[model samples]
Target: MADIAAASHMSLATVDRVLNRRKGVSSRTIERVLKAAVELGYLNPEAHEQLAAPRPPNIVFLLPMGTNPYLRLLGEKVRAVADAHSRDQPPIRCFFIDSFDAKALAAGIRQHARWADGIAFMGIDHPLVREAIEEVGASGTRLVTIVSDLPHPARETYIGLDNQVAGRTAAYLLGRFCGGRKGSVALVAGSRTYRAHSERETGFLSLIEELQPGIEVIGMREGHDDRNENYQHALALIEQHPDLVGIYNVGGSSDGIARALTQKQKSGDIVFIGHGLTHDTRRLLIEGTMDAVINSDPDQVISATLAHFNGVAQASTRNHHLQHLKIELILRENIPLQYV
Candidate 1:
């Protein structure tokens, strides 16, 4: 290995990684190492040729079946990645599963475990799902949690924003937007089964209590990330709390809440803050209905996931250095330009 490393003008560890087919070494580096090995008589010429061109690993993306605009955008981005790499890489499959059902989600994980070299999914915090992830990971498949996370040690890494910080940021923004108003605030969540949503809710409430003691949190309701359900919940909150001055959505389906606010003629009256940047959220921000949108770029999420599978050194850390994306706060005046 030392001789090959010297010949290749690379480090001994890098040469070892390439020779052992381990991750964190790029294809170009592998080729260079193999070429050096062939020249040094450490590897056969024919074997070197074969090792220089390795087959791309198959990756499966499991997204939730939902109407959430952000999730829908993620699905589209995943599909686009699959389509773009169809010719050079192994077939990439993206499946929409009932993430709310633990059994169904576990089954989906197990079903794809047979052929996937790596599996990325929006995780649900369920025992069955964790078992499936552990089982697949035990079989030498890489497991990644995206968007939402499972608090299990079996997964390789989580690729998303820090939900707790996102929630706290929302709370701070809502409190500030309300201008220290003495009124009640309401919270709407997608579902507590998703660790991301639950964490966001926890963070939001904790910060609200500490930072704005005067503002009362009326209560929290589950919207299931459904537009109609969120709409109904928002409407009910409006009726119940005539002194409502703010609302924090810990999950997606911001459009439904916007609709309810508009119907109640409380569009800009209530300080509304939610997660995810989508077409509807963009419109809401532009129209002055939403005070702020907390978001993580879908492109960054996808790139980080792919980088892990591709054996990029930066993404190989288990501490989620590369996978933990920055949180973006989008307001009406500072909304980013939309691309085609």
Candidate 2:
């Protein structure tokens, strides 16, 4: 590795940073080393002594786990990471909940605070849920929320898109895509009980009202945070307003929309915009049935959450970065070609 670094004319310390993906290395520098490391079989320091000797910090990730295909991938990424970090330190103990039940999720988080060095959780809003989070904080747990955020009693750091801005940005794209075809816009969202979806809907309608006054905003349906619900609701929506010109998927169910749109006679009748960078969304975007998907870098969420526990808590990212989160407007023209 040192020989490779020498050949590349970079310091060994710089090579180490590139190998481990430690921040502070410029993207250009990282690109150079990564290009080299890909060709090299091993990273420097034969054994992961640094990570193991200094025991990686204990971080409890409190998020949803279900049949979610994208989350399944996220879980694999988090777990694929070396458990013992560098073969010397105590292994990072990661725990997860298998359902979205608020009570169960709250309980799972509470269970971790006893011995955990810190807790990083996805924020959920609701009086009881918010109170439960506060209770965890009182117990001295470091909390964090991703994608959708928790308000009032905010967490130590939020690690996802500024949802409201994301929603507004989606609206902007939808308006641009609409090309002034004055028509009603339907919103498909998860439970209004969830703050993130609620805020996105709010931002969406606000932008539509301000920018496209002629465009009608239809009242939304509660997706209930369920895939089947999104599927059923989306079909019902098309049936309700056969002339509906645009769709804003605030929270759940991209597959539901594509499944609904499939077999239809219309090719690209109405515009669609939603969140997340899931494989299902990718396929739909490529097929041209779904229109635009706004992205929030889920990997960044992982890194940000890890950062707080790793000892450098970022207060606020740039507004554009927060709004975008490496967010891409995925359309048929520029959707990712492969999941790999």
Candidate 3:
């Protein structure tokens, strides 16, 4: 029981209160804790004593495959929760789908729909994908979305950073650090098809236009969150525009941007501000290869997602609850240590 509480990262008081049905518990927070406990089978032994009774509800967590490091981190957290609960009897079964491939992602989601008491998936403001997500939620199972979310036809509250705010933050840091120099800025991002990166780029360019009108935002490359592809683009951009003052990598491509920057002749002269503090980003922050990194904790995002999921389940919140986006600005002085 304590293990479940610890892995869920909730306080012992809260966990105890929920398990005991204590008075004065907020329905939303209670639901979150109960969901975690039920998913983990914390009451499995008691249930085994009564074979005729119905078992606990099973929730299915559908996540993207770990094609990127960020997704891997996400999977690790989910696995930790699942592992803690299934000590004897298997707990909630987790399903994985790759968001990069449209067909596979949709198919995996459809296949897992039948067994799920709850659903959590990512969908942006697209037409067909959005429609599919909406239809699935109508199946009477709780739905949760991670990363980018469809604001209008929402599917449970999204639990991730505000991509646009992150973009604007990146621009602000880069512009200020560049000392108002009128040089080009490279915008490396994930796939343009990914709504999160697209929104970030939009916000970043808007800020660049308003704040540093003189700084030419060049080298807009869809690095596809591929480090090598990012490096290739960065190298090409530098070759084309030797006077690049800063690089604004608004997604996973930041590592590649840092690598490219390291190879340049005037490496220290240029500045870099990117999003997310992956392992590579953390190293770069310490080494001063990157100027600033706008990041969010994946574990925190997962916790928030669970809280929002419970909130919606209890009718206390909407699917697209405007939870405050966390933006951590990392520098050499205040680099965050990665916790596994």
Candidate 4:
């Protein structure tokens, strides 16, 4: 019973309810327990023979390979959760491909469609990607877009926050923090290939124009979420616009921005806002290098993906349905205690 519980990643009480066929236990939970029991050879041979062999669900998570700690955390959590539930054979696999390469991502989808029961990925909005998603759907494989969404209508679900709202939130925070100061601002993104980043820039620029007329947006640059690239962009912004009062990073590698600010002696002078919360950002926030961080929980996103595979989160959150994740605004004083 303990082994079965462990394999199912469920509490002993929950396992008991499932094995005993209790009323409160959901069918999904019961199936998971029974499958674990059978895989562990805990079920009686005669009883096991009466039921068909358990065919574990196959789930593949395709994530971007980059220096972004947030994506790293996501991969770690997915692996941990997958390990917890795995018995003789694992059901989940995470594949990392080149960042911002639409062809590579689309190829991954097409390749995984052959074997994966479900595929979830941080999608890029592109014609080739949409074609691949549609092809995968037609092949009867479930597909979900995570973090960043694709423009395709074939994706089974999208699991992430409303990025436009997050952008607007950043604009509101930066505007309020600026206190009606007239100055130029700059925006940096990993890549506009990501719909989330583009959406964020749109909402941010729109709100800034409406609420803070004095603040001029210098322009946006593609940093590709690289430390050196973003650092260079920061330097260029400082050099071109000496009066640049603020910067909003729509993607990762915010530490690069911090370093640039420190070098220019404008760490606190320039109002800086970025996305994601890692150790680097935590320290920056405490040191006043960053004024705000708009974040989405990677753990929650992974959990939602897993729940979808388990048929636990499918009723309400289905195909093309947006499970708008919680968007958090972190300040130095209100930094979350849990780093990971």
Best by TM-score: 4
Candidates' lDDT values, in order? 0.85, 0.67, 0.68, 0.85
TM-score of each: 0.82, 0.75, 0.77, 0.83
Error of 4 at 240 (Å): 0.8
lDDT of 4 at 85: 74
Ranking by lDDT: 1, 4, 3, 2
Report RMSD (Å) for each prediction in the order shown: 7.9, 11.7, 10.0, 8.3
- Model 4 poorest ten-residue lDDT run: 48-57
Candidate 4, residues 98-199, lDDT tens digits: the string is: 999999999999998766778999989888888898888776678888999875667777899799998899999999999999999999999999999999
> Which segments of candidate 2 are over 4 A away from where they belong?
1-55, 82-84, 87-100, 152-154, 312-324, 336-338
* TM-score winner between candidates 1 and 2: 1
Model 3 lowest lDDT segment of ten:
48-57
Q: What lDDT score goes with residue 79 in model 3?
A: 74
Return the lDDT, model 3, position 52: 19
Candidate 3 has an lDDT of 0.68
Question: Model 4, residue 156: what's the lDDT?
Answer: 71
Question: TM-score of predicted model 4?
Answer: 0.83
Better of 2 and 4 by TM-score: 4
lDDT of 2 at 260: 71
For model 1, what is the error of residue 330's alpha carbon versus the real structure, in angstroms, after optimal superposition?
0.4
Over 1-340, each residue of candidate 3 has an lDDT whose tens digit, in order, gives: 6765776678898887666544335666665666566668765545433321323334566765643566666677777876777433224566667555666666665666666645666653455555666666666555666776656443656667788888888888888888878888888876666677888898888798789988988747877667888888888888899788888776674667777778875566788787766777777777888888777777787667555544443434444565655777778788755541
Candidate 1 lDDT, 251-323, residue by residue in tens: 8999999999999999989999998999999999989999999999999998888878777322235553326
